[model samples]
Target: MDSKNKQQNDQKKSTKSNGNSKSQSNQTKSTSSTKKQKQARFGEEHEGKLLEFFVEEVKDIYFAEHEALKALKKMEKAATSKALKDSIVQHHGETEEQIKRLEQVFELLGEKPSKKKCEGILGIIKDGESVIEDTDDNTMVRDAAIIIASQKIEHYEITSYGSLAELARTLGKDDLAELLEVTLEEEKQTDVTLTILAEESINEDASNE
Candidate 1:
């Protein structure tokens, strides 16, 4: 009888061990499935919130820079000072490069280069036009107009690029984040250059007039 009881206890222990093994296997499978699902959702983290806002914003940036290329030509032609004219031409070249960079970013995201109307940029350009028309100081007027227009543009880019960097980081796109950080720093540097030109050259000339 004691041996019979001992045999029953041994069988019970074996059954319990098998059950635990099955449970552990199921748990491991569940963990692996979860990891696979996360991998499948890789870029989904960038789908919502200001990312949609950023997409539209970047599209506007592309259009604005393209438009600025034409506007820069006009600004360059209208500029009286050789230094200011050279600056406008240089910026035109930079603008072209910036547009190309934006296209690269679009390609990275599997998108085509496209334009979106940017009312903010339109308004800024219109304001610059008004300033150019109203001021009779030809030597300083175009320079001032360029500062107004370019600074506004730089501010917009700074905002957009910063936002894009944040979005790229959130989406685990380290490469994109790095690219945007570089762009953002460039925009800031350009703005500083414009400020220096305005304060040291344009504004001083205007004051003398």
Candidate 2:
């Protein structure tokens, strides 16, 4: 009888152990599933936020480029040196092209090309206009001022395009990134040209004036 009782107890313990093991395994699976769900939710939210910000920045730069076109025209008119005028004219044409490129980016995203009011670009443009107003016309000083103002604008474009390109890449939009990088290179080249103009002659001529 005692041997039979011992056998029954052993069987009960083995069954209980198996039940506990299964329970633990199920709990672990549930925990893992919950973690995965949370990660997925967070990823989706992050992607949504990033895309929204990217679109907004695109709109901001769009507005800025338009404003820049107008500002470049004014600066070109205010400039005295033929070199400076030619550079401005080239950049003005490039700006138009950049705008078209931005429109293409919008189309890629299946969105209309729209402008968002960018106060920063407007402020910079205002400062450029002020430079024109402060400097005298038909003088090297005016040309120098124009160069400085144009460089400022180029710097802004460089920053905007560089950032937009990186963001586009992050969003897995390689085509958009490629477009933005092209503009970014153009902006950098324009900056280099402006710097060369200043260092080679414009600054010296302005100083003498």
Encode model 1's per-residue lDDT on 116-166: one tens digit a residue: 998887887777767776766566765777678778767877887888788
lDDT of 2 by residue, 1-209 (tens): 25698578656655655566788757755765686588679888998899999999999999999999999999888989999999999999999999999999999989999999998989888998898899888999999888888888888889999999999998999999999999999999999999999999999999998
Per-prediction TM-score to the true structure, in the order listed: 0.73, 0.87
lDDT of 1: 0.75
Residue pairs clashing, model 1: none
Candidate 1 runs further than 4 Å off: 1-53
CA lDDT, every model vs. true structure: 0.75, 0.90
Lowest lDDT block of 10, candidate 2: 9-18
**Alpha-carbon shift of residue 189 in model 2 (angstroms):** 0.3
Predicted structure 2: lDDT: 0.90
lDDT of 1 at 123: 83
**What's the residue-level lDDT of 190 in candidate 1?**
81
* Residue 91 in candidate 2, Cα distance off native in Å: 0.5
